[model samples]
Target: MHKIIVTGLTGFVGTNLKKYLSSYEIESLSVRYIPNQKIEINADAIIHLAGKAHDLKKVSRPNDYYEANFELTKQIFDSFLKSKATVFIFMSTVKAVADKVDGILTEDTVPNPKTHYGIAKQQAEEYVLGRKLPEGKRVYILRPCMIHGPENKGNLNLLYQLVAKGLPWPLAAFQNKRSFLSIENLCFLIKNLIENKMVVSGVYNCADDEVLSTNELVQIISLALKRKSRSIAVPKSIISTIAKIGDIIRFPLNSETIQKLTENYEVSNKKIKTALEIEKLPHTAQYGLERTIKSFINK
Candidate 1:
């Protein structure tokens, strides 16, 4: 049996990946307690998904991100290299490339991580890349854009909440293209990377077939929830001023939140698609987002 070990199994992406690949002999285990090599010694492959994600609340320490995202990954990668595991997949983030991409983000972009979270993941990627790999054993550092799936509570949820309340989407004036990866497509790429030994070791950015603007996202959410999307073109200046105030009031509609929603974070999936020999992602970006919005709205 081809057994696979996945860390951070309880997270949104890990949980969804498990549900998607239920037929595979997969085990979700914690890496903090169990030593890395001890757990991975006998496994066929390891998917390093456990990490301290970016703290939106700004409550976590700087070392926390480095240790959890970078150090823990280093431990696992070292173990996988020594073990029988033929493949290792580390779930990184597109943020490792840049905080604000001037144009479309692809695998070729030089990394300039602005946040501690991005820097940590980038360091982890560098650690793996610097190593001399054993023959036939490959490492993949995957940088995926915002991932959405069942029970996910992030920007998608915020959008869902706005649309579900039948409130006017007042921030449609800031139209920008952003890329999103569905949990389904991510699992597909991971499965292929594990089963196929021919895949070369390096970083790959994953995303759905197309990019969508915030307005388009609202439209999709509205359609999915069977509600009318009432959008108002609130002046960007006024909205920005309100968002600035929101920062002091601890309102959810702060400048940072607004920028994240409106900013362009496009990533290219060309490398992944070429590797999989597929013309397009199996599931449409809106399909996954729509499903998730409806799932949480009904809940």
Candidate 2:
């Protein structure tokens, strides 16, 4: 049995990953963000999932990102380099590369992170990649896009609630394609990496096979809920003005939320898929979105 030590074991991705890796012997590590905190690294595989997620509320301190994402990763990775752990999986984000994707986001894209959260993770990625590795040990930095699953309420949930209440989606004029990562697909990729001895160790973009626009997502929610989804083609300029006002008034549909809802952030998963020697992921984008939408109904 492969013994794994998982940080952030209770998080959305971590919890789902643990359930997927139920056959393995898993140990959870709880590390405080205090200075010089100790990390125990005794396992065949070390999956680092804990980090300060991007605060959409914008209330977090700047140092909090460095301490939680960069410093903590440095400490744990230092221990991993010296320990018997054969594989190290770091859960990075595509935002570390770019906040807005012009076309498809690939591994070759130069990183220019605009947020402290992205900058800190980029720092951690640099720390891991800069180090000279031992002959047997492998390191993998996974850059996943927006990940959604059952029971986790993210922006998708907000859309679901709006659709459930029969509210028309007002931003149909915003035409954009965004990539998403399903938790099941993420676990599948991680498991393949852990079990396959020949897969190369490097940064890989993790995302679903298909890209969906927000307008299409509304339709999917409607299909799942058995409702006729209504979408309004509101003018983009008007929406932008409203979002700017929302930024000042702290409305739900602020500039950031608007960008999040309508941005073209498509990520390419070709690198990881090639490494796994697979043509398609286990779950399709529609299948995963439907599953997640249905879960909201039961809640």
Candidate 3:
């Protein structure tokens, strides 16, 4: 059995990955940002998932992102270069490339991160690519967008709650499509990368093949709950004004949250799909999303 050492084992992605890769011998490694800290690798592959996620509330310090995302990644990657681990997978976010992608985001997109979280992750990606790997070692930097799955809690959960309470979605006026990554697809890609030596080492964006609008997502949530989907097409201007007020009053519908809800951030998984020699990911966007919504209802 291939032994895999995974960081951030307690996190959403890490927890799901552990369950998904049940055939592999998995070892959980706890990691935190400490200056000059070094890691010891004893497994055939290492999946680095431990890092500071983007702080939606804006309460995190700027240096905290650098320390945890960039510095910790640098330390662990340096260890991988020296150790016998044949595969090193770094979990990065699509935000590392661009917070707001104009068109479909591809592997060729140049990075221009807006937030500290994004910039820190971008730095880590550069560091990982800057080093030279041994003949037998392979490194893969995966940039996943808005991952969701069972037992996951985030904006998707918040949306599920709104639908569960029979509250009409108020942002239907704003039409936008966003890309999402299913945890199952992510785990499948990582397992393939670990087992398939023909796959090249480089940056690859991970996302479902299809993009869905917020309205469609609400419908999916409703379907999962066996309820009719309701949406109010209030004027965009009125919603913008309300969101501005929300920013000042600390309500849930602030400018940041509003932008997140109505953003056109589509990511392309073409490179990864071609590398894995597959026509499409195992799950469709609707299938993965419905599964996530059902999990929320079951809880």
Candidate 3 lands at a TM-score of: 0.97
Q: In candidate 1, how many clashes are counted?
A: 0
Better of 1 and 2 by lDDT: 2
User: Model 3: per-residue lDDT, tens digit, 1-299?
Assistant: 38999999999999889998999899999999888888899999999999999987789999999999999999999999988899999999999999898989999998999999999999999999999889989999999999988778688977888899999999998889899998999999998998899999999999998999999999999999999999999899999999999989978888888898899999999999999899988999899898888888778
- What's the lDDT for candidate 3? 0.92
How close is each model in CA RMSD to the real structure? 1.8, 1.3, 1.2
Question: At residue 149, what lDDT does model 1 achieve?
Answer: 79
Q: How many residue pairs clash in each candidate?
A: 0, 0, 0
Tens digit per residue, CA lDDT, model 1, 63-152: 888888888888888888989888889999998989998789999999999999999999999999999999978889899999887778
List candidate 3 segments past 4 Å from native.
none
Tens digits of per-residue lDDT, candidate 2, 1-299, equal: 37999999999998999999999999998875777767778889899999999996789999999999999999999889989999999999998999888989999999999999999999999999999999998899999998988887788977998899999999999999989988999999999999988998899999999999999999999999999989999999999999999989968788888888998998999999999899999999999999899899988
Models 1 onward score TM values of 0.95, 0.96, 0.97
Question: Which pairs of residues clash in candidate 1, taking residues 3 or more apart in a chain or in different chains?
Answer: none
lDDT scores for all predictions? 0.86, 0.92, 0.92
